[model samples]
Target chain A: MELLKQSIRQRGIALSEQVLKVDAFLNHQIDPLLMQAIGREFAARFREDGITKIVTIEASGIAPAVMTGLELGVPVIFARKHQSLTLTDNLLVASVYSFTKQVESTIAISTTHLSAHDRVLIIDDFLANGKAAKGLISIIQQAGASIAGLGIVIEKSFQQGRAELEEMGFRIESLARVISLKDGQITFLD
Target chain B: MELLKQSIRQRGIALSEQVLKVDAFLNHQIDPLLMQAIGREFAARFREDGITKIVTIEASGIAPAVMTGLELGVPVIFARKHQSLTLTDNLLVASVYSFTKQVESTIAISTTHLSAHDRVLIIDDFLANGKAAKGLISIIQQAGASIAGLGIVIEKSFQQGRAELEEMGFRIESLARVISLKDGQITFLD
Candidate 1:
C-alpha cells in the first residue's frame, strides 16, 4: 500500500484538482512489480474471505484483477464493455455509469463463469462514484454469488463511492485512498 | 508449449468450424495456474529477445501481458481504446480493424511510457488477421521504440494474420498455431 501511494505521489498527475492521471503506472501503462506487490497486499487482506473468483470490468480493471487473481490462485473473470460477435451466450448483464466517460455503459459476464457456489472478489483500478462496482455487484447478484469483498487500487475518498458501498455493508479495501486532492496535492485517508 | 497444447486440447471449446473458444482459461475467464504456465512459456520463447517491456491492447490482452511482464520481470503498458480525457499527451495512436465487430477502433498510448530506449515484446490473446498486432506495432513505431518480438497465445494458421505479420518481417511466436477446426476437431500446425 505504501509502495502504491508512493508511486501515485511520484508519477500520478492531478488533473483539475478532481482527477488523478496515473496512466504512467496504473491505467494506460502498468508497473508489473508494483502491481504484483499490490496484489500480494490484497491477497493478504482477503485470503480468508473464501474468494473463488476475482471479477472486474474491461480495459483498466483487467490488469489489477489478473494480478490479484495470480496472488490468490483464483480465476479472473472480466466483464466485457464492447459486446463482440464472439460473445454469444446467456450472460449476467448490468449497466454502469462512468464518471470519467460520463456515459451509461453495459457490462456483462458469462453465466457459466459465476454461480451460487462462488465467492466473488470485485477489483478495479479506480472508484469514484462507485457505479462500476455497483454494476459488478448487480451481475454477481444475478448469478446468485456471494461477494467476498471489494478491492480497489486507488479510491477517491472524498467522493460518494465509499459511503454508498459502506451503506450497502460491503467490505471495501483500497490500496491507496485519496482523501482529498487540493492544488495538485494528494492526501491519504487513515 | 506442451502444457499449453494439452490444456487447449482439454478445455478449449469449438464454437463453429473455424472458431475455437478458449475463454475458459485464456481470455474471458482466466485460470491463474494456467496463466502462470503461460507466463513461463512466453518467458521461455522470448528468452533471447531481451525484452524491456511487455505491451498489449486492453481487455482480454491485459492478463497475458501482465503474466508475461511478471514472468520477464518487466513492466507492462496496455494500450487503451477510445479517447481518455486524462491522457493529454499521447504519442502513438493506431487504428485497429476488428473483424468480429466489423469496426475500426483507434488504440492509443502515451509517449512518456514508451521511448526509443525500450524494447517492447507485444503480447495478445489472439491473432487472427494480426490487425491488433499491427496497430500495437504502429504505436511502438510512433514512439521510435524497437519491437523485440510478438508473443501470442493463439494464432489461426488458416487465416492471413501470420502472413501479414511475416510480410512485415515481425518475428511472431504463437503458442498454439491452430491449423483447422473441422467439425469441432481442433488441429495444430508445427
Candidate 2:
C-alpha cells in the first residue's frame, strides 16, 4: 500500500481538481511487477475468504484482475461494455454510467461463468462514482453468488459511492483512498 | 501449448465454418492458469527478442497482453478505445474498422510510452483482418519504436490478414492457427 501511495505521489498527475491521471503506471500503461505485488497484498488481506472468482469491468481493470487471479489461483471474469457479436449470454445486464466517459454502458457476464457456486471478489482500477462496481455486484447477484468484497486500486473517498455501498453492507477495500485534491494538493484518508 | 489446445478442444465452441468461440476460457471468462501457460509459451517463442514493451488494444486484448507482459517482465500498454473527457493526452490515434463489431473505432496511445528506445510486441486475442494489429503497429511506428513481432491467441488461417502482413515481411506468432472448420469440425494448421 505504501508503494501504491508512493507511486501515486511520484507519477500520478493531478489534472484538474477532480481528475487524477495515472497513465504512466496504472491506467494506460501497466507495471506488471508492481501489479503482482498489489495482487499478493490482496491475497494476504483476503486469504480467509474463499474467492472462487475475481470479477472486473473491462479496459483497465483486466490487468489488476489478472494479477489478483494469478496470485489467488482463481479465475478472472471481466464484464464487457458492449456485447460482442460472439457473446451469447442471456441472463443479466446492468446499466452503469461512467462520469469520465459520461456514457451509460451495459456490463454483462455469461451465465456459464458465474453461478451459485462462486464467492466473487470484484476488483477495478478506479472507483469514482462506483457505478462500475455496482454493475458487477448486480451481475454476481443475478448468478446467485456471494460477494466476498470489492477491491479497488485507487478510490476517491470524496465520492458518495463508497458510503452508499457501505450503507448496503458491502465491504470496500481500497489500496489508496484520496481524501481531497484541492489546490493541486492531495490529502489521504489515512 | 498442449494445455491451450486441450482447453480449446474441450471448451471452445465452433460458431460457424470460420468462427471459434473461446470465450469460456480465453476471452470472456478467463482462466488465469491457462493464460499463464499461454504467456509462457509466447515468452518462449520471443524470449530472444528482448521485448521492451508489450502493446495491445483494449476491450478483449488486455487479457493476453497482461499475461504476456507478466511473462516478459515488461510493462503492458493497452490502447484506449473510447476517448474520455478526462483524457488530456495529445495522443496518436488510429482508426480501425472492426468487422466483427461492425463499427469503426479509434485506438489511441500516448506518445510518451512508446519511444525509439522501445521494442514493441503487439499482442491481441484474435487475428481475423489484422486491422487491430496494424493499428497498434502504426502507433508504435509513430513513436519510432521497433516491432519485435505480433502474438495472437487465435488466428483464422483463411483470412487475408496474416498473408497481408507476411507480404509486408512481418511475422505473426499465433498459438492456435485454425486451418479450417469444415462441417463443424476444427482443423489446425500445424
Candidate 3:
C-alpha cells in the first residue's frame, strides 16, 4: 500500500477536484511490477476468505483481476461491456453508469462461468460512485454465487462509494483510499 | 505449446467453420495457471528481443500482456478503445475493424507511454484477419518506437492474418496455429 500510495503521489495527476488520472501506471499504461505487487497485496488481504474466483469488468479491471487471480490460484471471469459473437445467450447482465465515460453501459457475464459453486472476489481499478461494483454484485447474485469480498486498488472516499457498499453488507478492502481532492490536492485516509 | 494445444482440444469449441471459442480458459473465463504459462511462453519467445514494453489492446488483451510484462520485467500499455475523461490530447490513434463485434473502434495510446527509444512487443489473445495487430503496428510506428515482435496466443491460420503481418515485415510468434476449423473440428498446423 505504501508503494501504491507513493506511486500515486508521484505519478497521479489531479485533473480536477473530482478527477484523478493514473493512466501513467494503473490503467491505460501499467507498470507490471506495481501491478504484480498490487495483486499479491490483494491475495494477502483476502487469502482466507475461500475465494473460488476473481470477477471484474472489462478494460481497466482486467489487469489487477488477472494478477490477483494468478496470486490466489483461481480463475478470473471479466464481464464484457458489450456482447460479442462468441458469447452465448445464457448470460447475467447489469447496467452501470460510468462517471469517466459519462454513459450507461451494460455489463454481462456468461452463466456458464459463474454459479452457486463460485465464491467470487470482485476487483477493479477504482471505486467512485460504486455503480460498477453494484452492477458486478448484481451479476454475481444472478449467478447464485456467494460474494467473497470486494477488492479495490483505489477508493475515492470523498464520494459515498465505500459507505454505500458497506451499508449493503459487502466487505470492501481498498489499497489506497483518497479522502478528498480539494483544490487539486489529494488527501489520503491513513 | 502442447499444453495450450491440449487446452484448446479439451475446452475450445468450434462454433462454425470460422469461429473457435476458447472462452472457457483464454478470454471470458480465464484459467490463471494456463494464462501464466501463456505469458511465460511469450516471454521465452521474445526474450532475446530487448523488449522495453508490452503493447496490447483493451479488454481481452490486457491479461496476457500484463503477464508477459511481468515476465519480461517491463511496462505494459494497453490502447484505449474509447476516449475517456482522463485521457489527454497527446495520443497515437488507429481505427480497427473487429470481426467479432462487427464494428470499427478507434484504439489510442498515450504518447507519454511510448517513444523512439523504446522497443515494443505487441501481445494479443487471438489473431484472425490481423486488423487489430495492424492497428497496433500503426500506433507503434506513430510513436516512432521499434517493434520487438508480435506474440499471439492463438492464430487462425486459415485466415490471412499471418500472411499480411509477415508481408509487412513483422515477426509473429503464435503459441498455437490452427490449420483449419472444418466440420466443427480444429486442425493444428503443427
Candidate 4:
C-alpha cells in the first residue's frame, strides 16, 4: 500500500481539483511490479473470505484482477461493457453510468462462469461514485453467487463511493484512498 | 503450449464455423493458472528479445500482457481504445479495425510511457487480420521505440493476420495456430 501511495505521489498527476490522472502508472500505462504488490495486498486482506473467483469490469480492471487471481489461485472473470443493454438468457447483465464519459454502458458476464456454489471477490482500478462496483455486484447476485468482498486499487474517498458500498453492507478495501485533491494536492486518508 | 491446446480442445466453444469462443478460460472468464502459464511461455519465447515493456490494447489484451510483464519483470502498458478518435499532442494514437465487431476504434498511449529507449513486446489474445497489432506497431514507431516482438495466445492461420505482420517484417510467436475451424472442429497447424 505504501508503495502504491508513493508511486501515485511520484508519477500521478492532478489535472484539476477533482480529477487525478494516474494514467502514467495505474490505468492507461501500468507498473506491473506495483500491480503485483497491490494484488498481494488484496489477497492478504480477503484470502479468508472463501473467494473462488475474482470479478472485475473490462479494460482498466483486468490487470489487477489477473494479478489477484494469480495470487489467490482463482479464476478471474471480467464483464464486458457494451454500448447498449442487451438481455440474454445465458448472461447476467447490469447498466453502469460513467461520470467521465457521460454515457451509460451495459456490462455482462456469462452465467456459466459464476454460480450459487461460488464465492466472488470484486476488484477494480478506481471507485468513484461506486457505479461500476454496483453494476458488478448486481451481476454477481444475478448469478446467485456469494459476495466475498470488494477490493479497489485507488479510491476517491471524497466521492460517496465508499459510503454507498458501506451503506449496502459490503466490506470494501482499497490500497490508496484519496481523501481530497484540494489545490492540486493529493491528501490520503490516514 | 500443450496445456493451452488441451484447454482449447475441452472448453473452447465453436459458435458457427468462423467464431471459436474461449470465454470459458481465455477472455471473459479467465483461468489465472493458465494465464500464468501463458505468460511464462511468452517470457520463455521472447526472453532474449531485450523487451523493456509489454504493450497491448485495452480489455482482452490486458490479462496476458499483465502475466507476461510479471514473468519478464517488466511493465505493461495497454493502449486505451476510444469510440471516436481523439488526436492529442501528448499521445501516440492509431486506428484499429475490428473485423469481429466491424468497427474502427482509435487506440492511444501516452508518449511518456514509450520512448526511443524502450524495446516493446506486443501481446494480445487473438491475431486474426492483425489490424490491432499493426495499430500498436504504428504507436510504437510513433514513439520511436523498437519492436521486441509480438506474442499471441491464438493465431487464426486461415486469416491474413500473420501474412500482414510478416509482410511488415516483424517476428511473431503464436502459442496455438489454428489452420481451420471447418465444421465446428478446430484444426491446429503443426
Q: Highest lDDT: give the candidate number.
A: 3
Q: Best candidate per DockQ, number?
A: 3
Question: Which docking category, incorrect, acceptable, medium or high, applies to candidate 3?
Answer: high
Model 4 chain A: weakest 10-residue lDDT segment is A81-90
Looking only at chain A, give the TM-score of model 1 against the true structure. 0.97
Would you list the clashing residue pairs of candidate 1? none
The local lDDT score (0 to 100) that residue A108 gets in candidate 1 is 87
Query: Per-residue error at B28 for model 4, in Å?
Result: 0.3
Query: Which ranges in model 2 have alpha carbons more than 4 Å from their true place?
Result: none
TM-score of each: 0.97, 0.97, 0.99, 0.95
lDDT rank, highest first?
3, 1, 4, 2
Residue B140 in candidate 4, Cα distance off native in Å: 1.1
Candidate 4 residue lDDT tens string, A47-163 = 888899999998788888888998999999989885311113288889999776667888898897899999999999899899999999999998899998899999999999999
Compared with the true structure, what per-residue lDDT tens digits does model 3 show for residues B84-172? 99998598999999998889999999999899999999999999999999999999999899998899999999999999999999999
- Which pairs clash (backbone N, Cα, C closer than 3 Å) in model 3? none
Model 3 TM-score (B-chain only)? 0.98
- Per residue, candidate 1 scores C-alpha lDDT tens digits across A1-190 of 8899999989998886778899888888888788888888989999989899999888888777878898899999989888776677798899987777767789989898899999999999998889999999999999999998899999999899989999998999998899888998888896
Measured by TM-score, the strongest candidate is 3
State each candidate's chain A TM-score: 0.97, 0.97, 0.98, 0.95
Chain B TM-score of candidate 1 stands at 0.93
Error of 1 at B30 (Å): 1.0
